[model samples]
Target: MMVDDRAGRPATSSGSEGHVLSTPTLLGDRYQLGEVIGSGGMADVYLAKDQLLGREVAVKVLRDPEPDPTDRARFMSEARTLAGLNHPHLVTLLDAGTSADRPFLVMELVRGTNLGEATRRGGPVPPQRMAEVGAQVAEALAYVHEAGVVHRDVKPGNVLLREDRRVLLADFGIARLVNDTAHHTRVGTTIGSPAYFSPEQVQGLTVTPASDVYSLGLVLLEALTGERAYGGTPTEAAMARLNRNPEIPSTLPAGWVTLLQAMTDPEPTRRPDAQHVLERLRALAGGDDAAATQLANATQVAGATQMMTSVPPAAARPEPTTSVPRAEEPAQKRKRPYWAIAVGIVLVAAVIVALVLLGDRGATVPDVPDDVPSQLRDPLQDLHDSVEEAGQ
Candidate 1:
């Protein structure tokens, strides 16, 4: 299911007769709601017009007229977390308020499909584009994590790909503040989408920024392979990760292989942080060898573990290094061949014998060439004189 940040399958709510909005369904007295663009478990998103700003915005209104207290708190928590974050890669929050007793949130409407749809419509994305997507999403994750927010949902459905080649991470409805101890999940239940959950999330452990990285790794792997990391029912998908790590394809470029493997490591501490992920992804996107090399070294130093079920231990894996030569440096050292030096010596001896024969015939020998080596000249002259005496 493609879950748009603001749009999805129609969710029947009290506000309108199904997905279409009733005439002039105005909220906050400043925005006019139109047709439903997205729907989720919590809210229904509509393409709305902001009367004050005279711009198009997405309005997400609570689906239930009388929601549970905890659900309402989590919905409002998303608003608060989004309000504090102001990153270019993250969707911007416009407004939030209660209208007609329904809590609604206004956000900038991205004018393109989510990554889920894009990948499905257009099969496997190229390596460069995948790198760009990963880098942009990782950038958003780094910012949100630094702001003390953990985006519990980071699947392809939550990532929007704008028409202008820009990426925006959306749908923080299940986001949790890192320091807040209050648990949001019900007993024996998880929060995020099942197929994208990290190992820790599968085990009902604490979720962190690395969890987002693992999810993004799965997303990128799916994008490249055109197959979900985990398939089947929600429970089946969630339980699959606990026993095995997602299989990263061997055909992928080395940089992508290293990054995806490290990101999806079962041990949370072995996964690279969002910032480091961002740096490496950017390097991959830009084809920057130097930056890639630097990040690879950092990944090794940070003990970025590769969680491949079929592979041998880390010590057995070959060391991956980039040794791109600079333009100023020579490609290889010039060396004199042994055969060429031997041929030169033979030619010099033959030339000295010829000079001695000329002097014995009363013919003046030509002056030794100045190009000859100083030490070789004396030896050649002594050999020529001995040959001349033998001829006499």
Candidate 2:
């Protein structure tokens, strides 16, 4: 359950439509609203019971009822960004809709403490634990980047650590899709938390996956030092990194110092991708790359166990001496989910449609700030409409 910012009162706030979705309130005829677990500037997060799934979920409802169209569109973009992602270390978006013109996102409720609260209560984490947490986040970001998403905010508060000490990066409210033009990301208006902002972000520059790496670097630094690496107001903190680097202790765990510095480097091009960071952490933690190793083995097995290829039937079909798909004995017991393949094909088609839209929009540039991209001109009106349609 999320902690209510207003400790004493019920987690009730008037929505743009002038209604409060308090406890016992039923949303979409499925989610039984419970305690107000968390609150933020834009939305109030409620712990709700999913009657359909028979599980707990966190419902984040937008606070602004009378938001301008731009705000509404940005909300939809955030939702679509979350919807496109599917990864273990990222909070999954299960459902989304609107209640009385107020959009809400139904997400998997993550238990255990957020990294900010955990670090505050426990101080710096154990070295091995830190590396493990970092690895999980990096791996997740790698996946997110591969999907053409940039998590603009990568901070401790946005990271949740489960009981197993595994970490999940959450809160992509300000995340920008690859073809997204930052209409909201105007000059003189920075998007991310200042303490964790990259140097280019401070200057209002175009961001890439490496920008997330720089921010994650600060988060891990705070985890290790038990102190914030930057100081002053958000604006001041944003500007501080312009002339200086994060002060790191000369002494760090074997490979961490090098990794940390590279991540926080002022130059965006200098930072390593999330995958490399994950690989380095795995090396330092002395853990085998189970996922990579399995992929390699699966590739070899699949190639050798092809049922019918250019070769003759007897040569193509390996003798079924063993149950697993291997060269010598290729008795295949597992079959891939055809439905999953169909879904993949459908999603690819949808993306191709979206790409055409992106291309069409690229022809007509928006009158946005120099910092914003020319190709990202369209207001996410279509995405915003989809949210309402989903809810209905």
Candidate 3:
């Protein structure tokens, strides 16, 4: 479930549309809405019971009755994006629809607290536990990035810690497909939480999966240190990342220092991809040489597999298998028009007559090449015989 400090209170300030439920409310004819479990800037999450399936689920309803068109589109886009993704680390989307113009999403109710709240109350997480959480979130990122979606908003509040100790990455409302050009927010407006914004995101540049990697790096660093990588107001925090790299503590293991430094690099491309981050975190969590060896072997196998299936170098791209057919294709399609052959025969006969009349009788007529089509060649031969007889 999305843990919030504002539980049991209304999500909206003045509107009756998003007022807290003092009584049991039935939404979409199948969900029995109870107390609001989580509240955010855009939506309020309720602990609901799925009457149809007889299971406990969390429903997120938009906070405004008359939402901006862009917000509504983003709400629906989250539903669509989550519906297609199925992964262990990702929160599953069960159902979605609008009730009286207020959109809602039904997801599996994760009985747990978010990483932000957990860390705030419990202080810094141990290094091994932090690595575990980072690994899980990184694995989730790897999955979503492969599916062409960039989780533009990746932070501690969005990372849920289940009671069973499994971590889930949730709240994909601001997420967008990497190839999707239609943005929910207007141009020049940044979307994610300011403190967690990647450098490219702070500058309002085109964001990619690398931006998510950067944000996750910040998240992991905070999990380890119990402090944000940047401070001050939203604008100051967002701009600070662009000016310099996050401060990774010297007390962290050398492996962690290296990973955090690489992840929070000022240059987006300098950061490691999510899959690599996942492997590194997992190895770190293992805390032994055996795990390091396993990671090395896995990486070697992955490299060899990638090389085997990768596009061949330019030298081998022009396939020899198709070259023979390519060379013969033009000859196979070579065809001459019959009318041209006839015109040529007439022109040749006229030339011969002109030469004879001019007293150059030794000059001979030229014959057609052997490659002419039989359909025209046979007719030309008959025409040639007729011309010879007429001349005689």
Clashing pairs in 1: 7-37, 7-38, 8-38, 8-39
- Candidate 2 wrong stretches, greater than 4 Å: 1-23, 185-188, 287-392
Give the winner by lDDT.
1
Kindly give the stretch of ten consecutive residues in candidate 3 with the minimal lDDT sum. 304-313
Clashes of each: 4, 2, 1
RMSD of 3: 20.3
Clashing pairs in 3: 1-110
Q: How far off is residue 117 in model 2, in Å? A: 0.5
Tell me which residue pairs clash in candidate 2: 2-37, 16-65
lDDT of 1 by residue, 1-392 (tens): 11243344322223342466546688988989878777777787888889998988888888889977777887888888889889899999989999877788899887767778778878999888888988999899888887778898899878888767788999989998877777655666567799999977876667777788889989999998999989999988987765456777768877777777777766676678888888998998998745665786678565644322322333333333432221211212113332343456567677667766565565443434434445567876677566656655
* TM-score of each model, in listed order: 0.72, 0.68, 0.71
Please write out the lDDT profile of model 3 over residues 7-101, one tens digit for every residue: 42332222233444878878899999987777776777887889988988889888888988888988999999999899999999999988888
Candidate 1 C-alpha error for residue 369, in Å: 92
**Candidate 3 overall Cα lDDT vs. reference?**
0.73
The better candidate by lDDT, 1 or 3, is 1
Better of 2 and 3 by lDDT: 3
List candidate 3 stretches off by more than 4 Å: 3-20, 289-392
lDDT, candidate 2, 1-392, per-residue tens: 23322233322233322234553777888888776666665776777889998998888877677765666777787888888888899888999987778788899877677778777767998766787888899999889887778898999878877666667888888887656655754355556699999977887666778789899999998999899999889977887676467877756653566567667766555456777777776765664334433432333333331111221222233322212211211113213232343354455445545645554433322122222223332333344344334434
